[model samples]
Target chain A: MGGDNAPSVVLEGVAAALEADPALKIVLCGPDEVVTPFAANHERCEAHVTTQVIDMGEHPARAVRQKKDSSIVVGCRLVKEGQAAGFFSAGSTGACLAAATLVVGRVKGVQRPALAMPLPAPSHPLLLCDVGANADCKPAYLVQFARMAGIYAERILGIPNPRIGLLNIGEEEEKGNDLAIKTHALMAKQVPGFAGNAEGRDILTGDFDVVVCDGFTGNVTLKTIEGTSKVLFKMVKEAMMSSAKAKIGALALKSELYELKDRMSADTYGGAPLLGCKGAVVVGHGSSNAKAVKNGILVTARAARENVSEIIAQTLAGSDASNSEQVE
Target chain B: MGGDNAPSVVLEGVAAALEADPALKIVLCGPDEVVTPFAANHERCEAHVTTQVIDMGEHPARAVRQKKDSSIVVGCRLVKEGQAAGFFSAGSTGACLAAATLVVGRVKGVQRPALAMPLPAPSHPLLLCDVGANADCKPAYLVQFARMAGIYAERILGIPNPRIGLLNIGEEEEKGNDLAIKTHALMAKQVPGFAGNAEGRDILTGDFDVVVCDGFTGNVTLKTIEGTSKVLFKMVKEAMMSSAKAKIGALALKSELYELKDRMSADTYGGAPLLGCKGAVVVGHGSSNAKAVKNGILVTARAARENVSEIIAQTLAGSDASNSEQVE
Candidate 1:
């Protein structure tokens, strides 16, 4: 409901999901008037789907309180009551965050759930933590973020004991500010499965499984990488199109270029999961059209099947295991 | 002489510099015995081209001290006595920074000199400050960095007023961490000449005249941008060479691709300058070749001819327009 096309795009995503998966079920959350026409067209919409409409212009948090019928509020309630396996939202991130925390709640001992945004690599994507969820973070919080991200990688991305790297300046462990310095020490000692220090260039090298930083640096780093990729891609395209000779070369390379774009382009990565939340909520670019929204829904659905929350719980136990081992 | 190629590449750069500009004079420092042969044949090479070459295998800081005749130490000495205008090295960054500070001294009132690296931009190259100089930065240090970078832009890059932006997660004046938030307030009120807040995405927009951040974030941002450009270049080249059908198109587009490479290449700008020092010192890539070394020489020469140090002094003058206004 928060996307570029909002209800229409979301409805299309729902239709595409059901058609492709056959056994898929969705709880369409939006204004009844807004969603009825789209839902009416699908044959099994009424049987497999449940519609709890919310107002279009309503402030998501406040509306969640007053309107018991509001989609987002109802969706959270469904998860709380175990009527739904997991809640997914294309609604307001602020609204989603607030509702998820107040309604669904954080995992046991998890300081705060982080927004882990996956950066697409040539093969497997690199996951960065605290992207939008936690703005100001402590060293302790960053340590927890690494645990959560590491578990997510193991369960979702299928890597074992994923090497967690603290995003820092220099290769030297002593480099960076008080936060980075302390965080590095904490991850090295506390986070049992963590890799040592990782320089910024190490992200693309895929040396570390999960890269952790405070949201302030993490968000900036993520956006910087994103903005840089876009600018670089545009500049490269401009270069390829600069002269008659380059244009001919570009045409010859069109097929291979398309595959490369498909491989590296951020759009193909589906959506970024707000990981520490109780339910799997993947935030697609709010400007998502039909295809992007479709992919985002699928990502959340697959995450639910993977039991991401339980895997994170199990990894935290590994830290406890090493702690007890040292005590002996 | 501190580069990956050491004395050989450093020697080639000196030779190239001599060949290009007759007005360009060189004082080759390193093992004088090694450089003697090149100086004999090279036209610009003469008795005036003094050599105080330091030991190559020694530790950077210790090496600077034990042999006062070391290239880094001797070259810096030339700048100290006003025999030469600036120093250029593709050697150890640590050695260069140490030699410049201990030998060349810093501009009056300058706390820490920042290395402002120029990045390839569509319109003009960007100057990202504190790339490796001051890793853990304070608000005051960042403020000073903005001033130093401003001076470089105004004098060397010919950017007047030089709109400054503090790199952050978002463009909000209150968006960043403790350091960034404080710096933003100070920048808005203290440095009124600035362009206000800029996000990571804004770095390559060619919108602002200068961008400033702590070394941690700044270095990370720079490396990420560089990595993205490199990966894209490889991807494009691979696509262009993938197939015969595409090869025909590739053949037609050869000129445009060449122009693209020219526009995106980093060497065209030569080396990064360590700003706020009393004398000129350029730090090129450690892996730099002869042409890169020659360009570094020309860059320092231009800075010398343009009276960069004097302009910086004027730029920092509290009695002058900028600081007087800041004082008010």
Candidate 2:
């Protein structure tokens, strides 16, 4: 009900997750016809029937407020009411973000919730914050995003004292626009483990554990990488098919190429987590397959188990206390 | 002199261009030691000796003003004095941009000059404006950039009535930050052949002949594409080396792969044009080789031959006249 392949792929993903994790429990939220039969056949599964579905093109904020019984909205409500430990969705990104912010709510002292995605880099995944949230951001908001992203990289990703880099056009401190200039000055004093500025080339080089930017730049960079990789791979396939020798070579390299492709695919990470929310909320890609959906649920489950929200809250509170001391 | 492998590579490139075009003439601006020998040997090459050199990392505006004897400054001066029709440099980007704008001057009614680069797309090259000139821009400036880029695409790139797209995170006109939203509204009314908004994926898809954006986002997007391709190709090579089968496959695909790489390389285009200036000025990559320098000169030579600066000035004048009539 929430994704492109709503009921079937979602059900298959849930079934696979349940089989993989014996201790896991799932509450399916969708129309009765979509959820009832699946819940009946699965153990430790319950159906919370939703009456409506939000279309991908609908306005996010308006849809979340008006459609009370929509799957995205109802799922968020379940988290708010303590019925669910975490929520995952592959529906409209805007709808998911809006409902999570409105219903699940933000943690105290967090001015804005940022969308953080773990990009596949050479050595390990690098977390980029504000990927599509808060496109028009203040320098203060960017500093906060850096702090939150650093925490996520540490706790969930298990990288201690994670290095945070400011995403900019140039590596020099004085080389960017007003926002980047102001943010760099603030991050120098405020953010812990603040590495110097990272250029676009540094994004996939695995030089920094986390990078932060206004959502606009981050979003463009993310999509550019996706588009470039897709086009280049297509060209490579065509090149491989150009001659008999190349075709035979491609056959021999088939398994290795598949492995490399799997490493670069978004399905490996499964979903992007909405940071600064009180509840653990992960938003999957709309075109996610059953495998991606399963991985997304597992990531959400891990976030819940590790109490990521609580840890982020405590870290932010500690920073606030330190800031007040410095001001005084 | 200007680039990394200055005196030698620059001389080789000049010699090659001279050999290729029988009527072409070169006015070399560098220290006596670098330019004297080359000019003396070539048939149509002349030396205009300059004493100072601007370092790549020097402050742009300050360096241009102080280093009047530098090659970049002297080159622009040559254009201003009508001694040369165009100027080409592979030196400091900022210094080249500052010198071109301050010395060669701007077209009438042009607020700011922009850097336009032709990106190699699947079908044909697409023009992207403000690649690294104006970092922070107003909506009106972006509209002007679109107009300037459109002219460059049509006049030089040979695309007739080139479709222009406003680069943004989403295709919808209403989607984006303040600058994007405001620019989209203005472009729809102002820009001719306005094809609508283009997402990041659209940049490489060749859906639009030209795309306009603030320098910051454009720079980031450009570098991200470069970085992603490099890292992915490295990974592919490693995958091909994992076993004997992959090694044979790699050999078979070697020639085809090299052709694809050549098509995607920046050296193919040679240089980016600095549009809206009173003279044809092209800035080559800092790491440009002899071949790239030769092409950069060719591009500048063609721009000068076509009187691109005059055409752009006339186009702006015409657009301004039409806008005033609409207002009346």
Candidate 3:
């Protein structure tokens, strides 16, 4: 009810997720007409009819507060009330983030919750935190983001002692804006696996496990990569069509090219996790297909099973204590 | 004297530029051994011997102030003294920027000088302003950057009424950090050919002729595009070599692929102009080859011929008058 292709794609994705995992139970929250039939057809499924839907264009915080019976809000409420272990939405990113923060709440000691997306590097996946959460951030906020992202990398991605890099314009500590300079100084002393500063080129080079920045820079960097890939692929296709020999070559390599595209696509990772939240909140892309929705649910399930939120809470609390001790 | 392959590559590039444009004159500035022989051989070339050389890793402003005899410093001095109309360097970016700003000076009404880079979009090249100059900028400075960039696009790129966009995380005027929000308001009221806010994805979409941002975001965006292209092309190459059929296909499309690469390469654009400076100052890439250096000189010559600095000064003076009137 929140995404571009809501109801149909969402229902199809739920069905696929159910088929993939026999023990997984889903509680659909949408209009009765949208959820009732789907829930009745599937085993271990229940319908929690929602009266309202949050549109993609609506202001996130206002919509979450005004639309009490909205699917995004109700889904987050379900997580807070212990009815659901996790919430996955392929709807409005802002609405999902707002609902998760307001209803599901944040872990204690967390100043700001961050959105962490796994970038599909050629060698391995790299997690970029605060993709579009807190745009204007303090150095302390970035340090916390690094800590939470490191926890997520270890618990879910199975990366032991993950190296965390500070996303900056240059590799040197003295080479960025005010925020980056301050954050680099703090992260050096506070973070466990601090790998110094990573330039924009290092994001997808598989040099660091997690990269942290203010939401603005991270968001711009993420979209730039997406835009560049689309433009280059279009150029590649046009080049292939320019000649008969090239067209034949394109035909022979069609399947492999598609496989490469899938590997680089956002659909492969399915969704980005909202780290520092009390519940597992995975926000899927608004233009998500059925397969993407399915993968997003699986990621949510894994986070819930691993109790990632608890680990983040404990780790942050311990770090805060140590920081205060160092001050004393 | 300057750049990674100094003396040899720089001399070769000078020769190529002179050959291409018979009316052009070049003044070689470096050590006697490096510049004398080259200048002696060329018809319109003169040698200006400088003793010291600024290393790439040296602090920008500090090094520029200290290294009076260095190639970058001496070149900018030539521009200041009217011995040369422009300066082109494939040396340290920071050193070049510092020298140009400090020696050649700034336009009368300009608040801060900006580095404007031409991004090679598929449709036409788009100019991105403040690529890596002022990291933290005021709204007024951004307005000036937009004005300067728009002029550069119209004069050099030969576009009429070149559209300008304010780079932000989102398209909405309200959807950004403190700097973006304030800049968007100022640009809408002041900037000529303002096309509203452009998201990160809009940078390459050819929707806008010129995009303005603070240097930090602009730098991150620029490098992210470069990084993404490299990683994706490597993936494409790997995909091509995965099978015999694909290998044959790659062979058929080799020339077309290399052409596409050249079109997207930094060498094609040659150099980024340091706008708002008193003289035409072009900073070539550190890894620039002979061809890139030749193109850089051509770009510098074009900027000088167009009297870009004088135009920028007049435009800014008019804008400043209007702004003061509005205040009154």
Q: How far off is model 1, as Cα RMSD?
A: 4.2
Candidate 3 i-RMS (Å)? 0.8
Error of 1 at B107 (Å): 1.9
What are the runs in model 3 whose C-alpha is more than 4 Å off? Answer: A324-328, B325-328
Residues B1-328 of candidate 1 have per-residue lDDT tens digits of 5677876777777877877888887766555566667677776664333345444344556767776766778788889999888888887776787788888988886667888888877778788887877777777677878887887888787778888889886666756777888888767765546887778788888887789988778877887777667667777677777777877776776666667667766677678888888778888877777777888888888888877777666666663443333311
* Best-to-worst ranking by DockQ: 3, 2, 1
**Which run of 10 residues does model 3 chain A get worst, by summed lDDT?**
A319-328
- Per-residue lDDT tens digits for candidate 3, residues B141-202, read 89889999999999987889999999888878789988888888888899889999887788
Shift in Å, residue B117, candidate 2: 1.3
For all candidates in order, the CA lDDT equals: 0.74, 0.89, 0.91
Question: When only chain A is evaluated, what TM-score does every model earn?
Answer: 0.86, 0.96, 0.97
lDDT over C-alpha atoms for residue B19 of model 3 = 92
Give the 10-residue window scoring lowest on summed lDDT in candidate 3 chain B. B319-328
Give the winner by lDDT: 2 or 3: 3
Lowest summed-lDDT stretch of 10 residues in model 2 chain B? B319-328
Ranking by TM-score: 3, 2, 1
lDDT per residue for candidate 2 within A206-264, as digits (tens), equals 88999999998888888888889998999889888989888888888899999999899
- Residue A29, candidate 2: how far off, in angstroms? 1.1
Tell me the deviation in Å of residue A170 in model 3.
1.1
